[model samples]
Target: MAPHDLIEVKNLTVSYEEAKLPVLDGLNLSLSKGETTLLLGPSGSGKSTLMYSLNGLYPEELDGKLTGERFYRERPYEAFNPGELSRRIGVVFQDPESQFCMLTVEDEVAFGLENLDTPPDVIAAKVDWALELVGLSDVKEATITALSGGMKQKLALACILAMDPELIILDEPTSLLDPHSRQAFVETVISLQQEKGFGLLIIEHNLDEWLAYVDRCLLMNRNGKLFYDGSLAQGFREHYETIQREGIWVPRLFRTAYQLMERGIIDDRKEFPMELEAISPHITHGFFTKKVSYSSGIPHLSLENVTYKHIIHPLTSTIHKGEWVAIVGANGAGKTTLSLLLAGLKAPSGGTVTLNGNRLKEYRSESLWQEVGYVFQNPEHQFVVDTVFEEVAFGLRLQDLPETEVKERTETMLEHYGLAAHKDRHPYTLSQGQKRRLSIATMMVENQGLLVLDEPTFGQDEHSAQEIITLLQQRQQEGATLVMVTHDMELVDQHADRVLVMENGTLAFDGSPEELWKKGKRWLAHHQLQQPFRVRLEQAQKKGAAAIESARA
Candidate 1:
């Protein structure tokens, strides 16, 4: 192991009590202090498992068979005392709430310091410093449950920061945050790393927000083996095709640049641009394509002065048939609540929600569900059956379809979702990406007219997320209206016919995706929103190119 290495693993392997196959197999990896490394891999490719192993959770906190050697600070893992490893190597999980144990922000940050038997005076000062470092000093006494998703994430970081760990590992930390919050979170983490000089290992499916900050990249294959470890830019350039084929995400800018080069529209650059400003000078006339025009069909659902307690203010809107709508906003902005109201899952407190020509309240529960389907934010919440096959078939069976037809349709759905191989496995036993697929499969099996999905791509890999979107698009082509609550701005830019912006329990903006992007940056920032990477690139091309040309002249 290198002298600067904070943690090193040799011949590492871990296996859970499962049917077959170890989660991690013969993996060798290392992390050094004062460096930021972004971990990339297909969903369920053992990225999280590797994180758990590195932090000393394998074979102990987690019930597993571990066969390997790990070293910390050039010493063997066995040399550390109980709690010693965790104090030095802290992990922030995907769900921030899962790691929080205290009631308030101040107490939560202080909890870690107190556990180390820090003096009372030292605890208060450390808490303040950590909170300030994360920009949470004003909310120090706020209850954990009341904080927004972004705040909760910051608090989780603060807890780890207060402990002054040598290494900090974050697993999909920005998956639950909105676009603006995601940008802020990435900036904060990168800035903190620069100031504190802590080793950072982050795992994320989407690489847009992080590609600019992380200098090194580590990729793992589906078989839990290292694929590449090198400079971030060079790795993507050298193995672009291989990485793309492996179902890993390529930042949109890089993909666009590569596509343009392949089509002879632009020459290949030695380095991929990480910022919109860098992409400006390369813009060509062929780069600008005509915008797509979306048409609205007949209205399918309507909300007239809809208000649900304090969560949704009196809102009025119409959803047309054959339309794909995206609801986006900050954490407590009532996007999900609005979706629930539209799906007839929740009754509005003060207004009326209509389906077709009648009020939603007039229909029976069975009839209402037949027309409107809702997929929960957490995929596991909607799972009912034991096996993967049964979960997909459950909705079909509820329709009382013939056994033969049900079997055929269920098998087809399973095959389409790439779950045919694991049809016998319990739905709960599947990976996060697999569970999301099963949940959507169950909902789409019966062909409901109006489908509402919350964060459908939350835990998915690049390929799986694209597959899910394609499926939803197919259903839309079949005349199904879709309303999705998502934080993925790129998805909205590429797919949505209309966008809904929510803020403080009210509908702040409703328009086409392009129109939303046209709302100046100041306005978007006020609502805690930002343009997709593609739009940002386009803007830079239009506004920044003149300066480049002038300088060249």
Candidate 2:
């Protein structure tokens, strides 16, 4: 056993009761005290299972068979119950809704401390401390249902932090947060790591955001095998090609450097740049020099004084053709509600949405689906068929399209999205990224003029995210309008032609991506939207009063 290691696993194997194959097979992992490690792998690679096992949720909540040795500090795993493990290893799950037990923010934070038999006063103090750490003190008494998506995630982190565990394992903690909230959360985690030095193990697909903060990087294959474990710098240099080939998202500058090297456009004298600061000069030299101006033309889809309320409050907005608009806000900001209204899934409570001057209510539900395809946030929830091919072709099948057309469209979509190899596999058996692609393919099969996707890149790797961006770009070129609800600002900056900032079920700002950054910085901060590192770098390069303001803001 390593002296500084907080938790150690040897030959760990885990399998569910109903499954024939093990989810985790002979896995070994060691976390040292106060070290922050980033865990990277594709979906279904046992990353979540590993986090579950660390906190005793595997055998208990999951009804799984387990073998091999597990140790927390010096104690054996078998000696501790799930409750006992909670004290030593605090876990924040990927889905905020799943782990929340209490109704209010304050009570939720106090849940963990009270379970551990802490005194009332001590628990209260810890709750306050935890809330303050995550910047959730403003919503201490807010009901869980009233809090935004980012706010919910912050509350969950606060709950776990209140427990004061030695090992904190975050399972995609920022998976669903908007870009700004995600940035703030990552910064908060880095600060906590520096101040407390607790063992931090995070499972995340966004490697770029954490590259500067993590000390080490670990990769696991889909077979639940440990593929690599070492210092962050060494891993980036040695496994660069492998990571790219696997469709993992590395830092932007690193990817840019790799692409340039492949094109033989630049001399391969320097190692791949992992830090954002290092990539600034290269980006400024050529990348930002030739800026492509996108022309915004006629309105394709218009919302005339559109006002919609899910439970209460109204949201109204208009979208133009050839427009790649990102509808962004904290969770529950009516982003999803706006998407539903635009897709004709739900009629606006007041006002009207028009497609080519025709009122939305005038179109039949089935016909509306053909004109405006909507992809839900959770791909699994939208899946209806067993096989991937059948799932992707479901919409086409309903359209009563020719069998030949269905086959051709499904095959073309499958091949284009890299899902051709798994056409016969069950949709349930596919990885999270594959599932998301399948959903998009289904939506694309109809050639809808407008596509409304809620969190299109959720649960996807960097490579997959870029692929989706390309697919959306192609759709735009083909004259299909897109309205996406997202929390990823980088995705917005890279892909969106226009940005729609929402707040409390109202339209706050509707403009270009750069304009949003320039004008909505304070509003973005209030809503938990963090500016991208690229934008920050560009600001740093500028000089004078404007430059100072840009950098500071």
What is the TM-score (0 to 1) of candidate 1?
0.93
lDDT of 2 by residue, 48-110 (tens): 888888888767777668888888786788888647887878888776777888889999888
Which candidate comes out best when scored by TM-score? 1
lDDT (Cα, 0-100) at 163 in candidate 1: 92
Backbone N/Cα/C clashes per model: 0, 6
lDDT of 1 by residue, 1-553 (tens): 8899898999988887763787788988899999999999987788988888888777577666888999999988878887789999999887677788889999999988998999999999999998987778988888998786667877898899889888999988888788787888889888878888899999987688888678799988777888799988888888898888888888888887777667666667576666667656676775655434333579999999999987888899999988989999887788877888899888989989999989999999989989998888768778887899988888788789999999999999898887897899998778767888888888888899999999888878888888888898888887889999999988888889999999989989999998999998998888878888777877788778677688899
> Which window of ten consecutive residues has the lowest lDDT sum in model 1?
287-296
* Candidate lDDT values, in order: 0.85, 0.78
**Candidate 1 — which residues are off by over 4 angstroms?**
102-107, 120-151, 265-269, 281-296, 548-553
Candidate 1 lDDT (Cα, 0 to 1): 0.85
Most accurate candidate by lDDT = 1
- Looking at model 2, residue 138 earns an lDDT score of 80
